[model samples]
Target: MPYALTCTLHLRRQVQLLSILTVFSVIKAGHVTREGEVRWQLFNECSQGMLQTYLGRVNTRGFSDRHCLTEFHVEADFYGAIRLQHAQSRKYLCFNKRQRITLRFNGDSERCYFYERINHSGYSELESAWQPRLFLGFNGRGRFQSPDTYHVKRRCFYWLKFVRYVPEEELHHCEIRKPVDQHVRLEHTNMAHNALRNSLLNQIRATHDGPYKHQDQENRNGTYSL
Candidate 1:
């Protein structure tokens, strides 16, 4: 009976493994359904607790002077989200400190280079420091070949607002405003002034109170010097 139970457990494990393999295969195949087809929950198993994600499609339009634009909106509490949709039927979506998303076509050699960088340097390097230049490779026809320039589009959208935290005693007197460019500069300047004023007040407090008391007495008797 124990042996039979063990065999049943093993069979169940094999079925689970097969299910996982099938999902992985679908992801690697890069298959696309009709235009309106939606694949909800397709990535449920793969994306749970995943820090990054990607989506892409092929570029139907040939290389032209026109530019492609993508917009993203994210709240401040969340790290960030980047979506890269290429004309070449390629799509990449990721979320991280400096998230990156790129799409490339089959037989594209440069895609390998990008994958290496994404793995080694990570998303921060890709968004901030790495400025990937568009390169156009030519075919033997002397024609400007190498799938016209992949119209690349990128945007950084943040929606988190910061609230000034004031002590309970100071809250009544403190004023807060929507931080504008000028307001920020003014606040910084005011902070510096306040710091300097506090430093001067501390110095005065450190001095012996005797001299200050003596001066006050003299002033009361109308004998104090300017």
Candidate 2:
């Protein structure tokens, strides 16, 4: 009987040990699952933040295929510059608002000139002509405040450019002329017109259906009367 009793005690102890180990394993698994959930939440929050920063308040209707003269205003935290080009005329104009400077480019051996005051006689002429295809606008480094902060004196400038090309037609009839320096205040005009153009293009891509689908639909609907 004493031997049986000893055996029973041993069995009870083994069962107790097993129960404790099982509980520990369950706790560890719960901890791992909780950590994974926390990590996923963090990643989701970060992605949303980035999306808000870049894509928030984007203009939806400003994208189109028709080319025309356009103006824009630019405001950045530190420094800003504007570049404008007429698609048809090939005229290139640039302005540096922070530095109070302007650059004009004509497709000729006549090198580009830089000016301090827009219309002042003390304009500094650059030895090299302005290259619209190469360096059309100003390049500077600066930081931006979060969307929550309001910038009262955020440096603002106006930019103007013309687009004259149709997608299906050759660009031979385009006549781009460089803009002469004027004291006009075109606000938000400091953005490179080319950049805004590309943004417009991206907006179209984001919103419109692919060309193939449109064409396919047209074909199916017998709208291609060609």
Candidate 3:
């Protein structure tokens, strides 16, 4: 073989190997997340009872509880961007192409970042590969996010929602696992304890508070009230 032809073949092989390595790297890096194909649950800490209850959009407590409803269904795009669909109303939570977040029953769904923060620094530090700009935060009652909101304060907020990753099909079983507030359960247990205590006291009083016992005591003491 000619020396020049041999050199050309070597260069071609190098380029082909580089191309293959690039494709492999892209796949390993997870450019498109397959995990997003599963369903996600947004459980809010601001809810009344359990933290497992989802941050829903319908019939939720007003600004006092961040207006998060009972449940929502999360759907992800090809790029792993997510949209929260209300379980009952079927409406989607979107940015409204503005600062305020609202439920709009439109085809244009807001691309939300489903991720966690490195620290409790603020909403700005939420880690998502696709959406570093947008965030999900809560201020006890109202949930807020960035870029579309009017208030400068709304840009940064404490987390009010937590994502519960699960398959779309197993959603029904997931709902059953929603936890009850330990404090509330404890309170109920205390109330029952008190009730049982009161009942026992009443029985004791009825058994001992008899007229004959007083007479018996009087005879023993050799004294009479009559």
Q: Cα lDDT of all candidates, in order? A: 0.29, 0.28, 0.44
List TM-scores for all candidates, in order: 0.19, 0.19, 0.35
Best by TM-score: 3
**Model 3, range 1-226, lDDT digits (tens) per residue?**
6778677756655653353233222343656432322222333333322122234433223332322344455554565344556543456655444544566566363333344343332221223333455654443443343443424554343333333333335434423345799999999999999999998776655233633345567778898746
- The model with the greater TM-score, 2 or 3, is 3
Model 3: colliding residue pairs: 56-69, 66-141, 98-148, 99-148, 99-149
lDDT over C-alpha atoms for residue 220 of model 2 = 82
Candidates sorted by lDDT, descending order? 3, 1, 2
Model 3 misplaced stretches (Cα beyond 4 Å): 1-68, 110-132, 143-156, 160-226
**Candidate 2 — what's its lDDT?**
0.28
The TM-score, computed over Cα atoms with residue i paired to residue i, of candidate 2 is 0.19
